[model samples]
Every structure is written in C-alpha cells, then in structure tokens.
Target: MIVFLCVRFLVFSFVWPFIGGWREMYAANDAIPLFINMDYMKDPRYFAISFRRFFKNFLNNEDLRPGIYELRFSKPEKVCVLENSVLSSERTLDVIAYAPRDLATENGVSFEKEIYVRGSAAIGQNNDLRALVCDGDVSLAKNTVLRRWLDAEGNISAGEGCNLGVSLTSGKECLVAAGCVFRRLYGAPVKAGTSRKKSFALAARDDEERVFPPPPLGAKERQLEEIWPYSDTRFSVITPNRLWVGANSRILGHIKTYGNLNVDDNVLITGNVFAEGDIVIGQFCKILGDIFAQGSVSIGEGSQVGRPGKIKSVVGNQTVFLSSGAAVYGYVTTEGDGRVL
Candidate 1:
C-alpha cells in the first residue's frame, strides 16, 4: 500500500503539469475564431515573398484595367487596379497596385488604410493619397496632395506645386524641385560614426549604467524613461542613403541619415535630425530638434535651430556655421570652431 501510494503521487506530479499545459493550449486554439484562420494576409500568405507571388498569380490576366476586382482578404476587399494596367477606384477601401502597372484616380480618392503599390503610382490633381508604400518609383503630378507616411523603395519625384504631408521615405534618391511643399523627406540610412549602430551600442551601455550607476531618477521617472521610444509603436522610416528637401518644405519627425541632408529655404523641422555628412539648411529654415552631424553644419540666414532664443543644436567633430540672422536656441558644442553670428 505504501509503495502504491508513492507511485500514484509521482504519477500525479508528473502528469498534471503536462495535462494542464495541453489543456491551456487547446483552449487557446479553440477560442480563436475561424475567421482568423481564413485571413490570408494573417496566415502564411502574409510573408514578404508571398506578396510577390500573390501579385504575379493574380495579375496573370491580360488587358487588366479598372474594375471591382474582389480580392480574398478578410472580407473580399476590392482590388481596384488589375495587373500591369491603368486603373481607377471609386471604392473607399485602401487600394493596392501591382508592379509593371500604372494607377490613377478618376476623382480625388481618400484611403483610410495605407496604399500599397508595386510599380509606378500617380495621383491626379487635387487628389489626396494617404499613406503610400511602394517598391518602385512614385510621382506626384501637379497640384496633387499627398497625406501621411509616403514610403518608396525607389526614387520619388514630385512635380511643381505638389503638397506632401509628413513622413516621406525613399530607399533611393528624392528630388523635389521648386513649388513643392513637403514635410520629412528621407533618402536612406547608411554606415557612419554616430549612426543607428551607435544608437544600439549606446542603448546597451545605458542598460548597464542603469543597473550599476543607476540614473538619479525617481522610480516612476525611471520606469517611464525606460518604456519610452520602445513602447511607442509608431511606424518609422528606414533608408540607406541621401535626403533632399526642396524649398518651402516642412518636416516634423525624427530623422537619422547615413548620408547628407539638404534642406531648402523656408523649411521647418520639429524633431531630432542627425546626419553622417554635411547638413545645409537654407534661409528661413526652422528646426525644433537637436541637430547632430559628423561633418560641417551650415544654417542659412533667418534660420533657427531648436526654439527661438534657446540653442539646442550640437555638432560633433566639425564646424558649425550659423549665418547672420540665424540663431540656435540651444548651446552649440563642436570639436571644431562653433561660430554663430
């Protein structure tokens, strides 16, 4: 009887945990709705290469054009533009354009979701394209209005008098000439002395310092500081090379560049700006963020870094030339001469 009792207790101890875990997993799986399994984008179909395959197979039809093509997403979202064809959409659903294709809107269309296109995309005059993501080139025609978050893997060229909202990102070159208004244009992020790489290293050091030295912050402040920038789940742009913003443009976001950043006249940036090379802000430019550069930084006349009356710009290992009538709201620190008129 004693031996039997001991064996039974051992069995219970070993088997109960396994049973509990299995039951929990089963319950979790059973609680999930069938609709989740049917979502192609959420299932195995959401892979990066899957997009290429899905587009290829779906665009197999010749002479594709504008029509209500039902794509099996969660609930058969409209595929406005067919494969490699010029098309237009009247539906309010976010439109997806495939590669080797051209897409245009008949009237002004607003997408609640981000527009995903494979090839070239053109928005008609007076139309608003919200949040666009494309692997190929993108062009904004005259008088077109582009709203939030435009990202392209290739080049982006905007015509005269185009209005671009915040956060334009391109993997290649970005050229917006005169009469174009923009906020936040990015070319790419590259290797540099103080770059994304340094950020990672610094973050690690901060972690170590937090444990050893312990920053002199209250518990709440320390917790909040630890959570910031990590818990903020906003989509950020990542590029590899250069960035150029035309005259009269405005950008308000955090920018990190591996190459040079050129801002034309009357530009305003309200966030942090870091460049690996030279940064030249043209006349009447306003930057409300901390500015750092690996090379020379030149602010044109009538420009202000940080807020007015306070200097918030810093240069690393280079000269900072603030022209006459230009002011940096925060103090300037540089390895070279920091001359401000």
Candidate 2:
C-alpha cells in the first residue's frame, strides 16, 4: 500500500509540470493567424492598406512592429481616423484603436497585446474581439461590441452590451454597465485548457481533495477556478476587490470576489456568487445559482435566490437576512445567524 502511494505521488509530480508547460505553450500559439486568404483581401473599400505603406516608410528598427498596425484615412472625407498611432512602447504588441467616430477593422485581432482606445473603438458588427491585452485601464463608451479574452493591468469600465468574449483579468476592479455581457473574469493567472470534460473532472476532484489534504506550503496547485477550459463560455469571474455588477445586467458565468459585492435590481446571474465581504442582492432580481458570502448577505424583497428546488443557498461567517416577499427555493445555510423578516 505504501509503495503504491509513493509511486503515484512521484508520477503526479513529474507529469504535472510537463502538462502545465504544454498548456501554456498551446495558449501562446493558439492565436497565430495561419493564412490570409487573398479573396478576403481583395475588397479595398472594406479592407484598406494605407497603414502597411505608412509603417514601411515611417517605422524603423527602433520602433516596435506590431502584428496588426493601422493608420488610416477615411475616403472622400480624408479624415485621419488613426493618426500618429505609433507603437509608443516596444514592449507592447497588441491591438489598439484611436478614432473620433466609428472605426471598422477586419477582425482577426489576437496575440494578447495591449489595446488603447482614446475614442470609441469597434470592429465590423460581425467581428469578434479575440485575445487582446490591456496593460492599463480600458474605458469605452456605450454599446461597444466585443468577443475575446482580455488581460488588463488596471481597471475596466465598459458601457452597455459590451461583450467580454471569453476571459478577463483585472489588476484592480471591473465595473460594467447595464445589459453588458461577460464570460470569465479573473484577478489571478488562470491556467488555459483544451477540453471541458477533462477540466471539469479535474475540478470535481480538486473540490474533493481541498477538504482532505492541505496543499504543501509553497507548492503551487491549480485553483478550482482555473480548471475550466478556455473554450468554455461558461467560465468563472474572479477579482480581489469590490465587484460591482450593474443593474439589469445578465451574466452567464460564475462570480468570485475578494471584497464587497453590490448587484443591482433586475439582474440575472446564472451562476454561483462567491464573495469575501458583504453581498447585497437588489429587488426583483433572479439568481439561478448559489450565494456564498464571507460577510453578511441580504436579499431584498421580490428576489429569488435559486431556481425552484435546484440548488441550495449558502452564506458564511455572518448574518443571512432575507427581506419580505423574497423566495429562496432551496435550503439556506448560514455559518453565524440566519433570519427571515
């Protein structure tokens, strides 16, 4: 029995490092554009090549060359939409846009680069915002359409219907307006995956082991939140500070926060809500999931905690209060005190 256990342990230690390294390699290479079909490039009206010429003449070895660089002029009007838009930092290699009005680019934007939009930025309505990095704060006006993975070094504030395609990483906070959409938001580095079943199976096992063996002091294991595959739109949102999900917004993913969480009225959260501080769910809200709070939790009147008889609601280490006319479909558990008034 001892020999068997020892062998298994040695095998895991050896295999895990290789698996993790391979996954990182795959994620880094996944965004590379394999081919650019000439048929798609034929439309000069829709696909402009002004930047290619500009960069050839202006950019030297001293300037950073980006995978996708643009400095365009609007036809007939001759309005320079992308002006003086040089790679300000050699370290930056990402998609960036600077325009006063609508700027449409053919979207194959990838490679996890920093994106800066002085004015509102958009791709064609049909394009997706895939694999971009923001080394600083990202501020966008209303109704910005997006569908991609983002890594931000600062806060992210977007207006209504702004789509976070797959995953988001924020160094500080994430504030979204009403009716916005998101997939996953994380504050830490999350491991990328290739499949859903393997990821979830590993996640379930991790949950079971979390109660048994405490992790070694200084040894790193994947977080429960990091097991989900990158392809799965049903991912988790993680942050270390206050998480403010706006009114009437809809999230089709899980939320994990390290500080206070304020979810406004008429919002529909389709996954679990986990927070370290006080949590307030506003009136007329529908959470088709579980609530786990480290501090007090108060659900306002006309709010529903979970789908009818599906999942139980949990509150930790503080008071759990439910106001009048609020209906919790499943069992409610609180670590300190639970009251309904």
Candidate 3:
C-alpha cells in the first residue's frame, strides 16, 4: 500500500500536465489578438529563450516554429487569470507553475540561478523528503522543525506548538509566526556527545547507511495541522488556552491549555511548550500561534494567537518557554510548575 501510495502521489503532482490545449490560450486585459505571436530579432532573457525553445520542440517540432512565430490566441481575457490557469503546453507549465504562487509558481516567480521564489521564501532542500505537503490551512509555529514541507501547491497554515529547529525547505507557502522556535539548521553534523559521553562522526558517503540521515528530533504535531511524510518524533495536540510567561515575566504552577497559545506582552507564562505532545491552535497569532513542543517552549517577542482556543497536553517530557522580552496575546499552557527570569 505504501508503495502504491508513493507511486500514485508521484503521478498526482504531474497529472495536470496532460491537460489538452490549455496553454495556447492568451491572457490580456483586453480581447486577445485574433492571432498572436512574438517576433524578436534578438532573444529576450534566459528564461524567455528557454520558453521559445520548448515550444519549438514541445510537440517534437524542432523547427516548425521560429524563435518568433505566429500562433492563434484562444483565451484572451483569461490571460490574467492564467495565474491560476491550467497548463496546456510546456510553456504554460513553466510560466504558470501552480495556482497559488506561495504554493507553486502560477502567479509570479523570481528565479536566481537554481533558486526559485513563489511566495515569501525560496525552495531548496539537500535532504530526503519522501514528500513535503503544505496543503489546506496550515501554519508554522515560531520555532518549528519541518523535517518535510507540504502543499507547495496548496494552502498550509502555521501557528501554535512550533519550534522543532530543523532544516526547512518550502514547496508552496510555509507560514511561520513569531515567538515560535525552529532549531534545525542545514550545515555541519551537529556535534553530539563527548570523550566521556556519546560521540558520532559522519561524512558524506555513497550508501544507504551514509545517505539515510538520523531520525529527526522533530516536535510532535499540533491540531488542524498535517504535513506530507509525517514525522514520528514530534508532539501533536489541541489547545484551549495558554498563560504566557516570558523572560521578563514571572511564572508559577503547572501550565495547562485547552485551546491555543499566543505569547508576547512581557508577561509570565506558568507552562512549558511541551509536557505531552499533541497540540493545535485556531487563533491567528500576529507573531505566534499554537505550540506543541516536546522539550522547551521558547517564543520570540510579540507572538500572536488565533481565535478563541487553548493548547492541551497530549504527551510528557514537555516544557514551554519563551524568549526574553517577548509579548503574548493568545492562550497557552503546561502541566507542571514553570519558571521565568
């Protein structure tokens, strides 16, 4: 079943490429010209040249069309709409990648070398991602470790129970809030253990063992949150409310949440980011959202929250901490006494 699913998904990403005659349509503010074509003595840019070359051979017509050729324009008014339009030819697909720029490149794309930008970030990963999904309403907690990204072609929300600190690569739009913590950074192998402690040394090699990265120390998943290729180590839970505790605030008693969290106000939260695991948020944290950390919760200042919601505990070994001088305005929680300085 897993194998079948994998194959199906791989095909799913390109299924739209087969749509017939959708690319020839022209998009314009006014009616499309009865017939339109580009005839430039010289080439435009690297991308433009690539496009002309693709069309010349998209149907295996190497020289059927010249760098500047004539073609009929089917859809005119809808040219602007092509941002979300489907692909009829290779030109269309490359020009208008996805419906949502944040998810794909159907709208506007700025490419610098191999790096491409759709929404507010870039897409580049040097690791294994069976599949990264950022579909539907998804949010990224302030500091969340996204072992895998999702919905580069759909809407994915972020907030609450974030801060995993792992490498992140976007396919679509990855929403990140404030006061959230992401720990993972791509670079040298993390120094772990000591002479008297555990030690691990890794160098790039060619082998399954060398290729397979260690299981990520990812945080649990929160509510209303779903990622492609789920990570098994992170926490997942729903939140009801939160009592934020910042570095400049005071903390007391075990923290407990039933809704979501939004810390930022230089206040004190008597809870940790994770005590259980599962977590979720329904609020729109200006800076932060729900938290589902497994160890510590440290949010930045001015973290926001979503609608009326509370963060709940689902696992253990959790602690929610926030950055110094951070402000919170949403709900938060924990199960044991917490501290602030």
Candidate 4:
C-alpha cells in the first residue's frame, strides 16, 4: 500500500505537468471572453443620444399635452415635461426637465436635474445647472455654472466666466468667451471668444509667399520635408532639449521635444507635435495635426489647430489654455483644468 501511494503521488506531481493535465481539467470553454467596446466608450455624445432616444420613446407613449406635467414611472422615478417654452426666472426646478420647444431661463435660476431642450436654449446669467442637452443652438450668459455636460447640435455660445463642467460638445461651432473653464471640448471648430477668419486667411497667404529657411549646415534635408521647395518629405525632428521654432517658419514633419516647445507667431506645422514638457504655440499659428504634451499646453490667439474637414486632437496631461480667436477642429482635452483666455 505504501509503495502504491508513493508511486501515485510521484506520478501526479511530476507527470501531471508534462501530460497537459491542467489544460484538460480546465476546459477552454470555461474561460469567459473579455471585450471592451471602445466605440461606445469613446463616443462623447453617447449619453445625450441615449437620453434623447429614451425621452422620445416615452413621449410617444404618454398622453400628456403642452403643459408642465410631473411624470411618475416606477418607484422613485419621475420627470418633468414641458411641452412649450420655459421662460421663467423665479423658481428652481429639482426634477429632470424636458422641453420639446425652446427653453429660456432668467437670472439666478437653479436646476438640480438634467435638462433636455429640443429647440434653442437661452440660459440667463448666474444660473446653475446639472446637465443640458439641446438639439438647436444654445446660449449661456455670464457666470453660469454647469455641473455636468453640455451638448448642442447647432452653434453654442457661452458668455464669460462660465464654468462648463465635464464635457462641452457642439456639432457645428462652439464659441467660448474669456474666463471660461472646461475639461473636455469637442466641435467642428471650437473657437475661443470669437471667430477670426481674417487672421487665418492672412496666415495662409503669408505662408504661401514666405521664403523658407535652408536646413542648417551639415543637416541632411530629407525628401520628406513638406515645405514649399521640399513638400514631399516626411520625417520627425527629435530633440533632447527645448526647441523654439521661429516666426512664420513652416515645418512639414513631426516634432518631438524633451523640454518645452515654443513656437513663434504664424508658424505652420503640417505634422503632429509631441512634447515631454510644456508646449506654447504662438498667435495665428496653424497646426494641421494633433498636439500632445505631457505638461501644460497654451495656444495663443488666432491659432488654428486642424483643417475644416479633418479631425485632430490636442491633449495635455496638465492644464490647457486657449486664447481668444484660437480654434480647434476636433477635440481638446486636459487632465487638469482647461481655460479660455
């Protein structure tokens, strides 16, 4: 019996690993597949879209008319539906407010729940809101504080000193005034303060007529350079220290810097920019690609980030600042606070 037990133990310990016994015990079908849907996760408008869909479905079934009504669902679930416009300035709404038509509020009003407006929304000064979604244009007066997100299908104009919490997105144009703070912004052209078409036009004209400086001595000019004379070359410029590109200079390739990157006024870069340190882009500069910085990123006035059709990104680990007239075509995000100056 002892001999039998010893032999059995030895065979189980030593031979089990070599015979693929563990694999047989735990079948492949027992393991669950792991998958993350990035399309749903990365969509900025997912919440707004879902909310609208649910509200539309509820509206189809409900028999409520064009007045303000309190809708009770299951236990503890309620919503306030406003069929017409809301132009009140006196009271605070503590429920989820849904307006099919225009919604306009006066000063000092507070909304503690989410607001969905199908038409244009004009919120007055110093109003506090949780979240706002509008299918048409939206306008927010000065000192308004949004605790969550704001989304609009048409143009969105936020007055000065507004705190746009979480994410602010616009399908067309997003015009942010000075002293406003945000975390993430997405738009076709998100402009700071106002749109400066003339500045971009002038910058483009100057780039066409401007003469490019020759490559430094002993520096090999590759065929991938995208400047006027060498518009076909594509290369990356890597540096250990800080890099300062002069004013009106054009670079067709990517730039990577270990230290801070300072770009002068009216500079045009056709490729992406990566900086380990802070990045400062001067006024009226045009960047055709993305901008990624480990440190803070500050874009000067009249600067343009991507073209009209292309989608680009400006991501900063720290704070991001956009001066007046600065425009970004796609997305702008910062882990820290983002301010429009």
Strongest candidate by TM-score: 4
**Worst 10-residue stretch by lDDT in candidate 1?**
220-229
For model 4, residues 9-64, the per-residue Cα lDDT tens digits are: 99988996667656756766556658877666677776677767767777785655
Candidate 1 structure quality by residue, lDDT tens digits, 214-314:
22232211111111211321222223466666665444355556677777776655567788887787776666667888987777765656442333545
Report the Cα lDDT for residue 273, model 3: 42
TM-score of each: 0.36, 0.32, 0.19, 0.79
Candidate 2 regions with alpha-carbon error over 4 angstroms: 1-235
Candidate 4 lDDT (Cα, 0 to 1): 0.81
Can you write out model 2's per-residue Cα lDDT over 1-341, one digit (the tens) per residue?
A: 99999988987888866886788688885657688776665221121123323333433433333234443334221112244433222122233432322233432323232233332333322234544344455544444455455544555554444554544444544444444444443331111111111212122222322222222333322233222212222345677777766665655567778888787766666677889998888766666667888897877655665542243454555766655445454434455654444
* Model 4, position 54: C-alpha lDDT score: 69
Residue 277 lDDT in model 2?
93
Local distance difference test, candidate 1: 0.54
What lDDT score belongs to each candidate, Candidate 1 first? 0.54, 0.48, 0.28, 0.81
Candidate ranking (lDDT, best to worst): 4, 1, 2, 3
Q: Weakest 10 consecutive residues, lDDT, candidate 2?
A: 188-197
**Which portions of model 4 show Cα errors greater than 4 Å?**
1-41, 61-64, 67-76, 195-202, 206-234
Best-matching candidate per lDDT: 4
lDDT string, candidate 3, 1-341, tens digits: 99999888877766656443244434334556677456535211223234334333432533222122233223211111123322221122212122223332222222211111124322222111222322233333222233322222332333433332222222222333333333321111111111111111111011112212222334322342222221111233233434232222222212334433333333222234433332321111121223354444544322322211232222212443432222232223334322211
**Candidates arranged by TM-score, highest first:** 4, 1, 2, 3
Q: Give the TM-score of candidate 2.
A: 0.32
Q: After aligning candidate 1 to the native by TM-score, how far in Å is the CA of 91 from where it should be?
A: 9.7
